[model samples]
Target: MKMVFRWYGTGNDTVTLKQIKQIPGVEGIVWALHDMPAGEEWPMDKILTYKEQADAYGLHLEVVESVNVHEDIKLGLPSRDAYIDNYKKTIEKLATVGVKTICYNFMPVFDWVRTELFKELEDGSTALFYEKAKVDSMDPGELVNRIANELDFTMPGWEPERLKLLAPLFEQYKQVSAEDLWRNLQYFLEQIIPTAERHGIQMAIHPDDPPWPIFGLPRIINSRESIRRLLQLVDSPCNGVTLCSGSLGANPDNDIVAMVHEFKGRIPFAHIRNVRVYDNGDFIETSHRTSDGTVDIAGIVRAYHETGFTGYARPDHGRHIWDEPCRPGYGLYDRALGIMYLWGVWDSMRAGEVAKRA
Candidate 1:
């Protein structure tokens, strides 16, 4: 696994590139132009600037977390063609910067949903929490306000610009079902995968966080079977999955190890994180240690190793440990700690393999 870190960018993030470089085994940054809104083609100069910054710190800018597929594209509106055209242009520019993978999601209203950003854990360190009851009972508008008010920085998916159109977006989505989403997603893949193939960039779709529909919104890209169906949509290497552990792990039914083996060559990026789920259906992000959460992170890494995965992987989200006031899930201390834990697991496996050969 070629380990990477998620750096929001200069000024937008509390963690600096200097700090990221200090983390052992991290060779690249998973980044994007967060300031740029959806559907707009990213400027070449801006893309170059990020490239320059990563180069300065000896970090490769090969994996972009998202290009933020526009709502129009997900909604399958007539204007989607224009946005998709722009997406193709953005893909071309990112390819210029040597970006190997572009991670985007097709979740309709929100990229990911959490009821609490700092839900205190038993150990006193806090982490992103998802309360199923709260999500089911709360109004979508109210949930937006609660989440927005808590964040010092604009959360990626909960952008004010997009949330402003929430009512109409919800109304529009009311007309869209799971089948409709699958068809629209297929349309998107068919349109863009050829361009991605030509540019040598893997277009990875991140699975829906919580792996379930929320606020009456249809979520299709969550389950293992659904993922298999997704791969069949375009049937090209460029069309792929991000293989996020925490997102798909919420379902518990998703055999992540099986996915590692099954989707072997197609996954170009992996988000390795842990979450502890309760019988009540609430979950809180935990340290990357396998014991700390329900996810079999070590097993997942083992599977990756066994499959000869050399793709870009990152410690996805982390707890608010050491009183470090950082992005809700994207903190320095815990994520760095997570990286070490991952390395320990992976390296031990390597050592075991060498011993067997000997």
Candidate 2:
């Protein structure tokens, strides 16, 4: 697999390109036009600016973490047609700059819900955490305020502009059942997947964080079965899943290794991280080490190896470590350490294969 690192744009991130370039085996940056609002076509000049910066650091700008889905499209409104058209154009624009995969999610209202952004871990590090009790107790408005308060960097799904419409957005979705959400998603895929294919880009959907509905909202992309159905929606190579371990692993029942085998050709981007799930339905982002979290990092990697996956794989959210001033889970030291641990496993597997041939 081709290793990549997630790099928010200059001044938008605490981690620097020079620091990312130092990570061994990282050949690309999983990026996006973050400043571009949802449903708007990205500025061509801004896209070129990102390319120029990555090029200066000798990094490939191949995979974008998210080109967010507009709410109208997710709501299946009549206005959705306009947003879909905009998304199609965004796909074409990103393709022009060699972006191979556009990772996104269809979850309504919130992108990913977390009770704590900096929950202190046992080792003095902090991690993005989900407290089931707190989530159940708090309203969406309070949660939104908490998420936006003291945010060091961009939280993809927690965009303030989107959250500001919380009341109206929830009202719009009150009538939206899971089935309605699924239908809207299909409508979106049928319209845009072909465009993505034509542009040589894969439209990869990230799984619903926590793999469950939050605040009575519909979250359809949760389990293995849901993803199986999602692939069938468009049934094209360009339409695929991002195969996020932490998100899927929250359920404890998602067999991530099996998913690798099930959707082999479809997955063009992999967010390989770990999360420790508690019996209380809570979860926290953990290190890449298999023992640190519920997800089988080694098995997942070996499965990708067996598939001979050559797509972009990036170390996902990492804990705040070494007292580093970072954007919650987007800290550099732990994520860099995560890459080493992930590569160490993959390289060991490769060595074993080479020895067998010898």
**Clashing pairs for predicted structure model 1, backbone only:** none
Tell me model 1's lDDT, rounded to 2 decimals. 0.93
- Model 1 RMSD vs true structure: 0.7
Question: Per-residue lDDT of 153-224 in model 2, one digit per residue for the tens?
Answer: 777888878988889999989999999999999999999988988889998999998799889998999888
Lowest summed lDDT window (length 10), candidate 1:
151-160
Task: Flag clash pairs in model 2.
Answer: none
- Leading candidate by TM-score: 1
lDDT: worst 10-residue window of model 2: 150-159
The predictions' CA RMSDs to the true structure, in order, are 0.7, 0.9
Off by over 4 Å in 1: none
The estimated TM-scores of all candidates read: 0.99, 0.98
- Per-residue lDDT, model 1, residue 340, is 98
